[model samples]
Structures are given as structure tokens and as C-alpha cells.
Target: MSNYRHHSGYCGIEVRDMHPRIHNFTYVSSCVKYMIFMLNFIFWLFGGLLLGIGMYAFMDKWHSTGWVRLETFYDVILNISLVMVIAGVVVFVVSFAGCLGALRENTCLLKFYSMCLLLFFLLEMAIAIMGFVFPQNMNSFLEDKFTDKIIHSYRDDPDLQNLIDFAQQEFKCCGLSNAGYQDWSKNEYFNCSSPSVEKCGVPYSCCINATDISSGLVNIMCGYGVQEHSVAAAGKRIWTNGCIETVRLWAERHLYTIAGVALSIALIQLFVIYLAKTLEGQIELQKSRWAA
Candidate 1:
């Protein structure tokens, strides 16, 4: 068996990382072959989807670029789109390797795919554990790094402005903090003591119903002077709470779904890693058998 293994090119290449116990003398087990192929195909579809949406969002931003207040309007949305594009490209490359490796029973490609999956699994598990243990910390981190950027750069990009407005309205929330309109003071136009004509007015998104009492056509000024009112009075006119709490509440409501997705991805990575290891062992065994 050692002579046969040495004569064959497979074990000579690398048995260091292959599974210790060989389950099959032939190539990959039928179940592992089909299952890994299917998983890879599913990932391929998901990657394509991410790539498509990323490009679509990027193009939407490009089309709306002329409407932005700034001549150069690169911001979080653009950054997110680019991340999606890069993630999609990576998924495609790794998943394609898995698909082809499983189909052709290539041990090197299988090990490479396994390494990628193991790395992903470890990173995902670490993130999930950290997020679970420090949800508040995660929220605070995102708020400072992400929400603050969005708020400060709201008018710099029209797309970001529209997104913030939608989020505020949909969540029945206003500024980034529970302190409410105080945070809007960050906006030069909405600053409570600003000399500008737009002082003391929140965005139209903060207003309840968002319609003029008389004209009833969408009231662009519905949130005008709302920030100047007392909290009790403002609560009647608009959402007095801030987006952070509402977002936290929303996340709490959907915690199960989020956890399930995180666990599912991690488990899938683990499963791929196992299959790749088993396939590698089988490939080495098959080469030995062929030599014998």
C-alpha cells in the first residue's frame, strides 16, 4: 500500500490535510459529490443575486448623482455597493472551485475550497459569538461609525437623504439618539439656533401622516418648527423618539431570523469543509488503488 501510494501522484502531492480515515476506496462518495455540487450551485445563484443588486444600486446612485448637493458624492451607500460587489465576486470564485472540484474529483481544488469554507466558518462563528455577547456594543459601534456618518452627510448625497428619510418615517423615528431633535442640530439647516431660514425645522419625514391640513397634497413643510416644540407636544405632531431605539426594537423583533441566518451560514461552511476533506481522502485512496 505504501509502495502503491508513493508510486501514485496523489499521496505524493499532500496527505497532510486529507481526512485521516478513508470512507471509500473509489472517488468521492455519491452523497458528498451531489450535496457539495448543489450547495455550490446555490451559492453561485446567491452570488449572482448579490452582484446584480450591487450593480443595480450602484447604477441608481450614478443616475441620481447630478441631484446630489456635492459634485463628488461617494458615501456609505457607494461603499456598501462596492462591498457587495467584492463579496459576490469572492463567493463566485470559491463556490466555482467547490462545484468544479466536486464534479471532477480534483483534490487540490477541493482542499482550497475546504480552506476557504473553514476560514469563513471560523470568522462567522467568531462574529456571531461576539455579536451575541455584545449586542449593545455592536449597536454603539455602528451608531458612531455608520449612523453618525449618514446623519452628517445626509444632504451631501440625495440617495442617502432619501434612505434616511424613509428609515425615519418607516420606523416612526427622528434623529440618531433617543434625545430626538437635539441630534438634528448637527444639520446646519435644522440647527435650533441657526440664522438660516430653515432653522428649527426637522425633515418632512419626522411628521405624522405627512400631509398639509389645508392643501392635503404632500406637505413639504409638515415638519417645520417641529423641533422647537416640547417633547409632549412634538410627540403628537411627529415621532419624538429617535431611530436608534426603533432600530434596536426592530432588530429585537427579528432576532430569531437573524440568528437563524447566521447559524445556517456557519453550518453550511462546516458541512462544505467536511465534504472537501472526505473527498480529498477518497482521491488519495483512488490514486493508490489505481497504482496497485
Candidate 2:
């Protein structure tokens, strides 16, 4: 009878010990892990595509130019090819780490992905704060240096030239410079002193009726020598207003939409970071259980 009682007590204690405590639980949530993995996988594919396209564009530009002379870091940052390449690389790396880490249950990759996202979020916040605090300085910089760079570099790069043309046509405004359509004088071919036939002329994109209605053909020479006339006279032929003012007005009109998009991006970043961190925690917990 005494041996039976002792064996029964030991069996009861062993049963109690087998009950799972919070830290002892080894269950890994597949839902959270797979959700993070799928979202990151989609982003990874997009990033890869962007990276490939950016690489091709950069290489082509380099071959055509023979050399790139960037006077400052700002110049390098402003370069379309370099900008696309940098953005692509960042997105590709971050998304790759996130997806692989989540799928493989890797703590190291998850940590890296989370860190990058956090850093990006902080940087964006800082830029936003600076914009709010230094609106005048930002506006001055855009008006002076940025516009000058775009206008002068327009003919140097086909992509840039097309982008400027599209902006002018869409905004129904001429140059981004303060002088408006007269800013064409800064271009070599359009300069008043230039011997080219396009001298003192704005691009056809600035013309009001550059396309024929019946034939549906564009009149490429519509803006020829338009800038040589007075503003009152030229106003009848081409858009006389500067793109800067037009863009400012457009922003004012679409302020809510812009804000909503920015907020959505921020929220998405936060959610991704959260998911990454949660998966990291779960993996760590599982590893701890294994160790115990």
C-alpha cells in the first residue's frame, strides 16, 4: 500500500510538469508568417523588375555619354539613371530580406529588414518635418537650382527632354523657370544668338494648338520664333505661364489626394515592419523552446 501511494504521487507531479507554460510553448503561427512572406514576395518581384530596368538604363546612359561628371553629390542624386538605380537597389534588398526571412524563419534577415524599414521611416519623417519648418527655403531651392538644372539638362538627355515636354503639355505651361517661355533662350539651339533655325523659339509642346484636329498630326514648328514676340503677342500662340506656378496651383488643388497617398505609404511601411518584428518574435520563441 505504501509503494502504491508513492508511485501515484510521482505520476501526478509528472503530469503537472507536462502542462505548457507561456515560454515553454513551441507553437508557431503559420498565418502571420505566410502573410508576411506573401506580401514581401510581391514587393520583391517589383523591386527586381525595377532594379533590372534601372541597371539597363544606367548602363546605356553611361555608354552614350562616355563619362559622367557630377560636381556634387546633389548632381549624382538628381541624375535620373542614378536615382532609379539607387531606389531600385534599396527596394530590392529590403523586400528580399523580408520575404526570405519570413519564409525561412530567419532572425538575422528579419532583423536587417526591420532595421532598414525603421531607418527609412525615420528619414522620411525628418524630411517631412524639415519641409514643414523650412517651406520658404525649400521653395527657393526648387525655384533656383532645381529648375535651372532641369532646363539646362533638358536637351542633354532624351528621357529628361521627354519628361519636360510631357510636363509642359500636361500642365499647359511652358518652362519651369521664372522667365517662363523666355527660358528657352538658355538652350543652345533656342538661344537668340544661336545660328540654328530654332533660335528664340520655344518647344512645340508649349504651343496651344500644336495638333491638327482633322488630320490628327502634330505641328512641330508651331512654336518657332514664338519667344521673339512680346508676351502679349506670344500669349496668343503658346502658354506664357511658368510651370512652377502651374504646378503649385495643381498641388493646391490636389492637396488632399497627395496627403492621402503619403499617409497610406507610411501606414504600409509601419504594418510591414510590425509583421516582420512579430514573426521574428515568434521564431525566437520557438528557438527558445527548442533550447529548453
Per-model TM-score versus the true fold: 0.73, 0.85
| lDDT (Cα atoms) of all candidates against the true structure | 0.76, 0.82
Runs in model 2 with CA error above 4 Å? 1-27, 62-75, 128-136
The residue ranges of model 1 lying beyond 4 angstroms of the native Cα positions read 1-25, 66-78, 192-198, 211-218, 253-261
What does candidate 1's lDDT look like per residue over 1-292, in tens digits? 4322322346566334333445444654889888889989899889989988877766776686743233334353435565577788889889989999988888888888998888878887787776778878876776676655666776665656787888888998998775776677778777878896668888888888797678868776777787788998888878888787788789789999998888787776677788789888987888887787
Residue 42's lDDT within candidate 1 is: 92
Clash pairs, candidate 1, are none
lDDT tens readout by residue for model 2, 1-292: 2222222345466322333345444556889889888888888888888888878887897799876657876567667777777888888889889888988899999999999999999998887655556655656667787776777777777667887899999999998866899888888888889998888898899999999999999998999998779999999999998898787678668878877887898999999898888889989888887788
Candidate 1 lDDT score at position 106: 88
Error of 2 at 148 (Å): 1.7
